[model samples]
Target: MITLLLMMGTVSLSVAQVSESTLIRCASTEQDSLRISKNPALFKLRQQSEAVIQQYISRSRVNKRTNADEIVTIPVVVHVIHSEEGRSMGGAGNANITDAQVNSQIEVLNEDYSNTSGYKGFYTDSLGVDTGIRFKLVTIVRTYNSKSQFSPITDGDDLAEISPAWSTNRYLNIWVCRLNDRYLGTSQFPVVTEINNRTQGLATSEDEEQDALTDGVIIDFRYFGRNAEAITSRIYNLGRTTTHEVGHWLGLIHIWGDRNCGTDHCEDTPPAYTKNETTDIECTPVFSDCRGVNTRNMIENYMDYSPDACMSVFTNDQMERMHAVLELSPRRAKLVEFSKITTDELLVDIYPNPVQETLFSSIFTPNFEVFTVSVFNQRGQKVIQDKLNRTSLNVKNLPSGLYFYKVETASKTLTRKFYVR
Candidate 1:
């Protein structure tokens, strides 16, 4: 079962939009800086998370076993919040995206992250590695709002105003809607802290609940998925907006590091004087920075602000840094574990027809080694699956539909039907 909050009283404010020629306007670092300033305690947490990553990197250099080659699968849930007019209009209009468009974006993510795309031939010698990260679509949510566009004083506030997210520790929640501004996308970085006695080191719950309302990505519907209609801009139509934002989500800073000759914490990516040349889809010319060092910048790196067609690689150091975040960050680690958990457990009850917020299930026993619960749609397709160690499952994010659930224990499997209204 899920909790729904209705927001009252909205203030509309005007802001600058992105230029028509710009490829992507990622506001992740800007949003993160604001959050750290407002909550000073997060400064220390950020320091701690960085320290862990540095230590992990140092150890990996000395010991080969420090980092494993296991692929990380991240569950995704897209929240499509559209105006009634947009919903009625449908197709590729603003705030009105089709399911195929969403799936195309996911396909792009898998290809780019795995380096399996047809454009892999463009990878330069500087290309170092594949991030070994993959995404799975867990569900899709559609919401209706009268507001044509949403602008958050903070991205967190905007998420709360539109749709509440699923468990951030378990799933990546993406909010796709019409933006009053010109930004293509924004994302939240991983943070380390403790929450409710749980090791939510990567992302704390209180901050995620209040300051960061939802911990994931927010994309403009026009640039969300790859399709002729949704591809409002020729340069950004390849579904790389979500790809770039997810890089930030997984701790990959811009290749230029958002500063002149700044460090992106990766050794392989050459230092750039600035990210000014990223607006174009062509290869950048060789240039020297303040250090008088001249070299051709890796304009093709995904972390750069380059157009989707010009981006292709994640250097070895970048992959190592992201893998470290996955292994050392507690919340991220737990999420991976929860995703891999599977078993058979006896279920006693799944109650309350026309489920309002959360759905509750009573287990016959709690001593099973591994118990799993999953939900399926009327078509018998598995829509939601997670370790059911607790008595409740959040269904608030589920659209109004008929669904069935199966509980698996060591000795028995139980199935039930429920509806969300």
Candidate 2:
């Protein structure tokens, strides 16, 4: 018994996984010497991406406002590029990614971005900033192939030549696939990439266009994603990997950047950095890298390197920067159109307001993905899926109630609500 208990107690972890309380204590202990270190690579790239994004912003007609005229709701399209090993067609698992996983991820973003998770320790007790960005998973699908051809057209269209790629101006296109050996996630002077990797497990936009890095995020599928139907395999399963990466995509930098010190250099965030260079988060509180100024590192900021649970705040300044990007960046303009594509903002409809069973609707897409429809609840849970071979659905036995229908194609999502009484 003693041996077993001791062994269990000895479970070890890296510095990244330190607890919030311990992170705070470590900051308290290293009150001095946590000087800022120059991570030239990170700094250079950050400047570059910012510059390119600015150029486009300057030229955009929407650059008139420094902040949003209103809280902008962006639609998201997740292209689940899986191995043939485990997809709807593959033997490995459902490979067809369930509506659960998709919905869970979206909910995570909404909660984190809204700053409503009840974790505000990183920022001063008095400071709080709300990033008015809300992402909704269109009850639609935008699946496409690398060629960007139409996908399950009965749903969307085959995403052929995703060139001019899905316009970033309206919709945020997130391609979740098996990483191509050639390119990890991509981000150019302004583009972003998010992918699952082996070594880093998960990583976000590293591009610093100015310094030659692309902007994006990556996650090891082993983390929040699974080849099987959706289920949270572990704590970090739906924790905040994408939230962290999306922060980068929105132009928020790592609070500590390449060094540690009093000021994270972002003026908006407190100064703090970890020199520990480790990634363990399962152990007791671990003291962090040296602390230069009395400033506490925003370890909880989604942008910080802390483990997903430890990081959780976005300051007003961060919001300003993101808002700046949205108003100025070319990709943001497409959001409205994306909303149209994914949510049927175009008003495409399915008859039978309350579907007792048979519900039929035409899914129209200017382009991308050949699709299939999946029914989901308000919680964004998938209730049913009708393959694309048929445009209409026979929802004969589903209990009558309100349900939202999603038409998924390789390139877009088209959704509308109906009744099933």
Candidate 3:
């Protein structure tokens, strides 16, 4: 029998290690960093890997990835592993970072990724360019208690996943947790890396784990920083941290281009990396520390190594590169595939919800797999016939109009409509 390997299906977190029944309870605790130390194995491994990666970068010369579109929408799971304090708000001078902070971060991400207020002279042409990237803070807290069942604390993005390590096509997966060993956050290397979760080298893919544990991004409660765990009223706001990490998640190389600027493939971003600085510095605009000429320095971009407040703008070239990345990367294209959607049988799906030309679906569930989905125009003409996983017909040839779709995956199949603008 041919079987489907799904990431984010079921993952049993070692919750017992921290001696907490709920993740929310755990995140609320005000543990000192001195008290908590990094796991020897993870620390050593990260160190060694980073060093080797640097060497590899020096040996090879490739353009750095600094574009936003290259990184598709990565589904994020924010684990608000609270401590005993339970949404502990240490108010006043040390008032805890409230749920307001969490919501604010989500808002910020939306505004930032959507490039709403962001297109102000940040790019080279100085004209506002919209970055077609979306960041959704998942409302579901996909956690596994001792019982091996999904815990109920999911409070971020609620877009339920079939598993972890999504197709890398339609959606990017992110897990926000405080469970790592003294680290703020970490992510898997995109495609063709020793860290390939599918091979179980560094991280495990969702398909390999057979649960919902492997698909999304994980941010720690303690360092998810301003978002969920401002419990101590202490906001260790590192704007570039999330921006930087997400850049990596989206497959953008550092603006400084790792060892030198020539390796990462970004001609515009120069090599001006400071090993580890606590504060943001004034960098050269179009500065070419490594490569010469017309360099934008690009340090101020979200993908660069600048501070959060300092980072702004995504170049048009970056947008094109990101699209190119989408075309070439398999995991990226999987976002639109049926393999990522959940099969509760009740979840509704609309093909061409934002239909450019045509739409398709192969929705199969426990209740119904061979159901019919009808398409209707504003005039309500049944214009199309579609069978899930049956054919790849041409819908693009159709005229632009308000179209409705009716699909049946299981017990009760229904219809939904969208316009083909």
After superposition of all CA atoms, the RMSD between model 2 and the true structure is 17.1
- Which of candidates 1 and 3 is the stronger one according to TM-score? 1
lDDT of 2 at 284: 24
Instruction: List lDDT for all candidates, in order.
Output: 0.69, 0.45, 0.41
Q: Which ten residues in a row have the lowest lDDT in candidate 3?
A: 26-35
RMSD of each: 9.6, 17.1, 15.1
Q: Give the TM-score of candidate 2.
A: 0.50
Question: In TM-score terms, which candidate is top?
Answer: 1
Candidate 2 residue runs with Cα over 4 Å from true position = 1-69, 89-95, 120-125, 139-165, 178-219, 225-235, 259-265, 275-292, 333-421
How many collisions per candidate?
A: 19, 91, 81
By TM-score, the better pick of 2 and 3 is: 2
Reference-based lDDT, residue 257, model 2 = 53
Candidate 1 per-residue C-alpha lDDT over 218-270 given as tens digits, one digit per residue, 9 for 90 to 100: 88887787875856676777888898898888888887778888888898888
Best by lDDT: 1
Tell me the TM-score of each prediction against the true structure. 0.74, 0.50, 0.48
